[model samples]
Structure formats: structure tokens, C-alpha cells
Target: MHLSEQEPSSWPQWLSVYHKRALLGGGLLLATALLWPTPQLTTGQRIALPLDLSSTSTHFSVPDTLEALADKPAFSTTITTGDTLSKLFERAGVDQQTMYKVLEADLNILALDTLQPGNEISFYLDENHQLMRLEIDFSLARQVVFTQVDGSYDVEEIQKKGQWQPKAVSGDIYGSFYTSASKAGLTAGQIQRIETILKEKINFARDLQAGASFSVALSEQYIEGVASGDSQLLAIHINNRGKQIDAYQFSDGQYYDANGESLVRAFLRTPLAKTYRLTSNYNGKRRHPVTGRIAPHNGTDFSTPIGTQVIAPGDGVVTLVTDHRYAGKYIVIDHGNQYVTRYLHLSKTMVRKGQRVTRGQPIALTGNTGRTTGPHLHYEFHINGRPVNAMTAKIPMASRLNKAELKRFKSMVSQRNIQMGV
Candidate 1:
């Protein structure tokens, strides 16, 4: 052993150092395997690793997803029941001051009293934080609706019309005429005629019984596919317990009792039935009653009590309504191109020029307002403006009924009468 104790050879010393390094490397590899985890989150939601950790920070690529989230849209509101303009603005999150500005911009826009339910309104903000469109629906009468567009409020009117569809309605009258007519699909025009026809015979509100029944043929008018009012009545049959009636619309304006004759007369027998006298008869050319001079006395003079109605002489158009020293209030009518008539000495003129006057239409009231000693109606008739006696002037009879038309008319009449139980 003493023989070489030779300086612990340098080669052996180097080999010993290399073995120690190999052992340290093996320990580090084992530690790393237990420390790191695979990436689980997307790029947009990536997490940062601590400096003490072996792995670097990583992320997933997700630009498309983030962009979609930022592009979501906003919405506004529409009008609903029991809502007012103030309430509507509040729901849209618009300020009161802004609403005032919008209203000021358009004077014809929505008003407080005209708002209607179920109308749409929109809201949005512009880049400058200002509102753009403001609108209110004004298409319908007595209604208002507001809307917004392009960051402003705009209003448009919605027109609602009653649908005009043919229908058959029948019901019993328990109370008033309106109640009964409403059940029968009868419109205002038809209801008016029904009252006119029955007013002389019965008082609907007082006389209608629970058993009284009515059948109506009529149409209804609708706006925006919504029924609003009733149209004209085509035909009607009313059964009032024992009283029965069938009426048809005639060209003369109202329904008839199976006959074409008008229910209204061309004239009343006298202006006042209680106290009236024929002061002067109609004459083409005669001595004037007041002046006692030869002149054209073209009208009949009826001395009547004050306030007596001076009715129309016939169906005509009012051509003149005037007041003169001699005729305080007077009306002239053109029956046609050939026939004309006049009424004079009135306290009040009930008609105007260019008005259509029906037979028995009240043109004025009697009074001693004109050149007269008493209240009277100075009536006159003329053919082509030449004065004639009104009392003796005979109206041409209506044209004869067409044979074919008459036959059809009679058939309809018979069927209606049977239905009416007449």
C-alpha cells in the first residue's frame, strides 16, 4: 500500500465530480413532472403563472367572442292602457326636460288629452347624447300616439275605421230604442229612420216591452280592421208584441211601410191648426192687400199665431234666405228647373241658402215682422219665375211605376208584410 499512495490520481477525482452532477439532474426532472398542469382556459380568459413556477403564461385565441358581446342592442317601449305621455316618457327612461323639448319642436304632435292605448313608442340615444325622432299618431280623430326614430321622437296618427260588413241581428227591446237598435246591428242612420217612423206610432223608450223583438239587415264600417260605426240599414222588421212592421229603404231617403209613398207631407194643412185664417188667396196678378194697388200677389197669406211653423211647400233646394223691409225673414225654394216657391213674413229663418229642404221641412216661424199687421206666411209658387197661385197650383203627379219594377216591388211588399205579421 505504501508502494504508491501515489497522489490520489487526478482522473479518479474528476470522475467523482461527474457522478454527483448526474444524480442532481435526475432529481430536478422528477420534481418538474409533479409541478405543472395543461392549459384549460381560453385566450380571452387566460391566467398568468407566478414567477416561482416553471411554466410560462399562456392564452387562447378568441377575438370573435369578445366582439359579439360588445355589439348587443338596446330596446324601447310602446304605449299601453292607462298610460299618459308623462308615464310613457318615464318608461323609456327619457327625462322630463327632454320631453318638453320634443313637444316644443312640433306643435302638432301629441297632446295630453288625446293619448290612446296600445300605440308604440321607441327610444334611443345618439352619439352626442341627444334624442332624434319624435312622433304622435294623428291619423285617427280624437286619438294620439307617439313614436321615436333615429334618436328622435316621431308621431304618426293611426286611423281606425268601422268595418262595413253585412250582418243580420235580432234582439228584444227591454228598455230604450238605442238599446234595441244596438242589438240589431242598426247604425245611426238606420236608428234615426226607425225613430222617425215609430215616433208617431209609439214612444220607444216608454212603449218597448221585454217581448218586443226587432230584426235588422245592415252593414258596419271598420277602420284598421276594427268595427267603429254602423252603416245604413238595408231592411228592418220590428215586432212590438201585437204591432208588427216591415220596412224597406226607398230612394226618397227612408224606409217605408211596404208602400213607396213618403211618410212626410209636402206641406202642413195649416201653419197653426188652432188659430189660422186664409187672409188672402194666391193670385198671379191682383190688387195688393196692404197697398190696395194693382200688383202681383203671388203668394197665399195665412194669418197664423206667432211662432207657427212655416214648413216647406215641397221637396226642394233653398235658393234664397233674405230679410227685407217688406219681408223681414223670407225663404225661396227651387223645386226644380221649372218650379219655385217662396215663404215670407217670419220671425226666424230656420234654413239657409243652398240647403236641401225636404217636404214639410220647417223653413221659418210665423210673426208680424214684415210689412204686415199680423203674423202670417205669404206663400207663392212660380213656373219659370212667373208668379202663380200656390193654393190652386197642382203639382204634376209622380211618374207612373214601371210595370216590371212594380211587380218586383209588390213581391217584396208581400213577403215583408207576411214577416211583419200584418
Candidate 2:
């Protein structure tokens, strides 16, 4: 019977095709069998099924060999600002599955919502398609791991203690601090930190001369032969115009000037000449106006009308300048040694990087840009990479003047106080 003779649903599609072809061959086969005489020895001839043979069953029983797995490279990338957890994983060459596993493994320790810039994620895979390790370089200070166990991962944190090797170098400010420091084999981070340490007492960023001399004794950190981070300022000295200021990082983690005075003795000077209207006070932390997020506000804010000139609190080199959303326009000055000063929320920058500026010199024009509600100058003073409240900073009384200069300043103070009827 032909398959088409039956209903459409009678048999499967594949089976219907086979059955139709079989029927077509059956008529020819019947004719051949009748035309050709029934072959003799038919009793001895018998159809044999492949499975019916014992050897066939044994031969098919052998399984095919498996292929060896390939090895993968361990890779990681540091996170930058405006990065999300998903983006971080992609840069590290990980898929969504791995990212999900990593998030689940250390939900508390590695919160996706709290991830910061400069963090690194490292991936580890085995030949068996298993996630052997999911590591994170948190703050470049430690490595956190998530190890697989029976298909599930367990979190384990490992602190990496970096190695520090003391190095000493000297260079003159031929053109700029960065160029001069780089020529001496110093990284950008190191150069920036040095500017921050000495920003308060000296103003190299804005006042650096072409022939300024600087000497630094610092600890260079190494993680497998790569410079990682710095700890303390072992020693630093900067000489300009016959004035030499030195700072030493003591064993107790305090930075002292060569005169044994604290490098952090005073607050960052307000760059604006007139403190007309105080816009923002020195707070431990403040919210970024543009980002609308809580961040440490390292400086004080002075408000004034637009076009008001801004001054340099200390001598330093202009390191960075940009028109940021919140800061509007900002300038960074690096003081010789490790002191750095930052002036933000400006309408214009009067001075550029590598330009020498003196204390009270015009560096910028006041206005609102970054994280501001009005026009003001945001001033910051950093020492060893940490922001200090500029308002409460107590400047060490300008060194006791020599007898003659002391008498002169005393008379001046007395005369001024009398003139004001104090």
C-alpha cells in the first residue's frame, strides 16, 4: 500500500518518504524475482543482520577517544571612572555567566553598586571549563578570590603586601615638574604625590623657576617588578631663590619639614583675594553637584561674582587644566617635594601648567563649574594624597622673624591694630 493512500497524519514525514520509495522498488523487485529463476542454494543462503553477529556488537562497543583541553591566559584590567561592573568584566575577557557567578560569590564584599574606579578584576579558567578563580585587585592593595567548589564558588580574601625599595633621585625643573620627573624615571603618580606633600609650604606648580632644584628620598614599591604604590615620603628638599624647604617622613608616619616642622602645619591658603561670600565651608565630605553623590570635599569654597581673579595659595606648577561639568574649569599646582594644590570651579585659568607663580599671584578667575550651586573658587590642599580642610588649617606663625624683621613686623601689626582701633 502507498503511504499517500493513507491520511496525511497516518505516519511521520520522514517515514512517509521512505515508505513511498520502498513501494516504488517493490514492483520492479517482484518482476526481477519472477524473470530470473529462483536461484539454487537458497536454503544455504540466508540474510544476515549486522547486530546479529557477535563481532559486530564487540566492535561497536568501543567508545571514541576524547580530545584534550586547551589552556587559557590569566588576564585582568583596571577599572576607570564611568565604568560599570558589566563593562569591567568585558574588559577582563569574562562573560555574563562569569560575572553573575562572581557577584553571587562575594555579594557582600564585592558589591557591584559600591565598586570604585581603579579596581581590577582577574579571571581564571581551567581545562575542564571550570572557573577556578575569580580575583579582584581592590585598591591595588589586596587581591580577593572566589574559588569554585563542587560547581559553586566560595569567597576568600587575600591581602597582598607590597615590597618597597628606597630610591633617591635629583633633578632640576628644566621646563616642568612632570617632564623633569619623568626624565628621572619617576611615574606620574609619584610626581603628583610629591607635589601634594609640599603644596602648602611651597608653591612650585605656580611659582616653579626653570632652574629649581629638588631632591627626594622615597620608597619605590614593587609587585613582581612593577611599581605599585608609595607609603611615606622618606625625605624631600626643594631649593628656590636661596630658600630651601625640606620635609621628612618620620618612622611614625608623620611628615616634617627639614626644620622638624610638620608639613601639614597650616591650611591651604585661599587663592581668592576677597572671601566676599563664603559659598562652601570646609567639610570632611560633600556631595558632588553634578554627580549628586557624596564625595570627600578636600577644600574650602569662596564665592564671588564672575570675573573675580583667583590667587595661588602656595607656590606650585600648574599640572592639570580642564573644563569639567561640575568644576567648570580647574587648575592643579604641584609644589616641589610632595605638596600639591588644586583650585576648582573657575571661570577661566590665567596660568597654565609649567608656568611659575608666586603666592597671591593671579592663577584663575572665580566661577562655578564642578559641584557648585553658585560662582565660587574651590580650593584644596593635599598632603601625601589626602585632602585637608583648608579653613581650619593653622599656618605655623610665619617663623619668628629675625630680631630686626620681628621688630619690624611687630611694629607693623601694632600699627595696623592701632589704625583699626583694635
Candidate 1 lDDT over residue span 179-290, tens digit each: 6676665665457556655454567767777788887665556677765543555566778887766566544333455555433334433333344578888654566556
Give the distance in Å from residue 143's predicted Cα in candidate 2 to where it truly belongs: 12
Model 1 worst lDDT run, 10 consecutive residues: 40-49
In candidate 1 the C-alpha lDDT for residue 417 amounts to 45
For 1-422, candidate 2 gives per-residue lDDT tens digits of: 11111111111343445435545867565344324432111000011112223333212111111111012223345666777766544533445665565554442233343455767655544322234565565655555667666555656555456788767777777888889878986777667667766777777667778788777776666777776664545666677757776666543344555444556433235676765766667665566555444545557777688789888776556767765433457788766445667777788889875776766788888876654677777777765545667666543333323556444444543433333222
C-alpha lDDT values of all predictions: 0.52, 0.56
Most lDDT-accurate candidate: 2
How close is every model to the real structure, measured as TM-score? 0.33, 0.44
